[model samples]
Target: MNSIIYGPVPSWRLGRSLGVDLLCAPGKTCSFDCVYCQLGRTTSATTERREFVSMARLTEELKEVRGINADYVTFSGTGEPTIASNLGQAIDLARSILHLPIAVLTNSSLISREDVRGDLAKADVVVAKLDAHSQELLRQVNRPMAGLMLSDIIAGIKLFKSKFTGKLCLQIMFIEANKNFAVEIAQVASCLLPDELQLNTPLRPCPVKPLPPPQMASIKGNFHNFRNVVTVYEAPRPEVKPLNLQETLRRRPKL
Candidate 1:
């Protein structure tokens, strides 16, 4: 599937990102089947943690990286990067091999596990999802795997943020379903105290549409309590191209 290493794509958050896929199996594998997922539905949704890809192979492929063309080495392709049993080791390998800042984009479903948070702690920037505060709406929007609770996820995120020394950005995606709870989500954000609050809406191939500019703008206002905030509607995307068609389709689109 050419899933080992792909893209030096223009990312809304990380700039030119070279994606490293962890769950590069035959098809999509993840813990959440979010309605607005660009990579489509999860073919194998699970709560287990195991090495889905070889750590040695990732190290070898990273050694073969050709140029100093990427801004960040991102663990983002395929599925939730934290689910990889070798994530902590993978981050270590990538760091020793490539002289680039590491970024991990996680769905935060696995954050309840202390090990998962520890693995993610290696990254320079961790973009964690907080789509909904209420469990019912979380279930509807994210459609997390069985045993994943909204309360646990929030608690884990809070714990991680408290210990994490790197940049922590809480990504809050707005849609029709969760737009009404902007204030509630902001309250949760107040507790986490992330370095930045990324206000986002879908901008990829998905059934759910991005909320209108004004609607999303209205939602952004509620998050003024945060020190810094950015939104997808007005944030300028880099003119450079992103991932190729295949890699673009394999990972979650621009957040």
Candidate 2:
């Protein structure tokens, strides 16, 4: 059987990360079909939250990797993890079973929802995405589902930051489309007062090419006020051997 738990995969920010996919559905079931998504286009773009994977199944998978060597057990897979209605329970269960820090990667589309915010609050680290500074750019880059406004998303992040005591890292994926808006995005990141700020480009194989390191360096300059700013080009990735190479590549494929 295919397991919901995969990887001790190398991560530039989180090191050797173990993945927990609550929504392990076929194709990319994201809320945003990003122009630079490595997983390709979004197959399902709805904002409805439901249980895609059962607790028993996730529990069984977690038991198999109880003592697995990993830096963090991440909630990310086939889609926006926040869309999983049982995310809070899954995070708690993963922590209790694996005894590892829980991290969640989310496209901020659903962050504005109270229930989604509640679910994400259970994580030790929440890497929230902020790719665009305006609604127009948001449509061009993130291509978020309808009804998701940029203003509301920003407001939601600030609200979550106010209540969340954990590490709230704002991850900005810079593409040719949004590179010039770095300062505007940086201004919002500053207002949210995230624990860390990540400057990323599409380094993986995708439709768009990554911004050169020199350009990314100039973008980083806009975020000079941030205490913990990590650029994708500068970050070091820890070497890791996945217990299931096939499964790891299914989600995070080789470049």
Candidate 3:
């Protein structure tokens, strides 16, 4: 059987995160073509939400994860999770079978849509992206889909904040393109008022050279307007390393 899931990858913020690929394959589809995307650019940037994978199959795969130790069961792959038409169904299935908290790492592109918001409302944690404050920088860094606009994205986040009872973390990826607008970005983040604000820089090589880590003191001083703040950088993870072929097979014996 083809594995639609990958990685109990060590994350700097979330401990061991088990990832679910809602896209067709590992690197096949996505909504945005971000400049600093660790997985590189999107091969296809479609906004339409559809059932890319069968709910029954995803449910069976999730049952297997119950035996694995994971801090979070994440809805993230090479693409956007909210674009999966069956996302709400998948979340329900995973919740029923697994004890781990459900987390969705999204670009916040479609959260403005009521249906998307309704789908994500079921998750335990929603980490939405807000790397750019202005429309110009948003286009430069995120390179969002043809019709998506910055206002729409921000509006969606605000809407999600109004309704979602779960934890909301605003993930800001600080690249050179948006570094100068950090204060403006903070102001925007203050408006959304998420539960936590996670500031991060690129950990891997990007289409362009990523920005040096923002001065922690300086960023904190500027973005202190947000109620709760947490900053993450491209720091070394001493406890974690990429799993080799043998170790990977060992972890998933059935594979």
Candidate 4:
């Protein structure tokens, strides 16, 4: 079987996370062609749920890497994890097959649907995204598929947080384009009542530059009222062993 369980990569939030690619398609596949995405653009961006990667194959591949030491088994790869039809099954099966806790990183485009929220709830931790507060800004930055409303995504995040028992972290990736509205975005996140708030910036091989640490710190001031808020730019990172050269390049290569 192909190495479906890749990485024990260094993550700012989750120590050494082993990645499980549920939608390891040929290229970048996502609901949004984010301007700051590490993988450039989404070639197969769609909201339709399908068997992008089979559960049986995931199980077989995971079994091959059972001996690898990891802190978390993350459902994240080339695109949105929620787009997979069997994401819930994958998480449940992974728990039985692996000792590590499961985490799902989603863009939050599909969270408006009950099925998407329910599927994400199975994970121990969920990192949901919210980059813009206005529709125009959302389109400029996230460039989501047609018919995806910013209001609906925000409402969905709040709804999911209300029902989910696991840890919920709201990721707000800051860029120069959305810098002015950082405070507004923070206010929206406060309403969601996420267990944790991650104020982040583009820190990958994307075309845009990351927000300056001092500037990010200034924005962090607005979120002071929200307990457990973390400035991702200031998070500590320990040495980590990546899955391999190829995997690192494919997922998130350091520039």
Choose the strongest candidate by lDDT: 2
C-alpha RMSD between model 1 and the true structure: 1.7
Top-TM-score structure, candidate number: 2
Clashing pairs in 2: none
lDDT of 1 at 194: 94
List the RMSD of every prediction in angstroms.
1.7, 1.4, 3.9, 1.7
Q: Candidate 3's error at 224, in angstroms? A: 1.1
Tens digits of per-residue lDDT for model 1 on 1-255?
365777777778877888888878866789999998887888989889999888878877888884657888989777777878999899888988898899999999999899999999999999999999888988999999888999999999999998999999999889989999999989988998899999999977688988999998899889877889999877766655644656655555433
Cand. 4 Cα-lDDT: 0.85
**Predicted candidate 4 versus true structure: per-residue lDDT over 182-223, tens digit per residue:** 778878888999899888887776889999899999988888
What's the candidate order when arranged by decreasing lDDT? Answer: 2, 4, 1, 3
Tell me model 2's lDDT, rounded to 2 decimals. 0.89
TM-score of every candidate: 0.94, 0.97, 0.89, 0.96
Q: Rate the local accuracy (lDDT) of all candidates.
A: 0.85, 0.89, 0.77, 0.85
TM-score, candidate number 4: 0.96
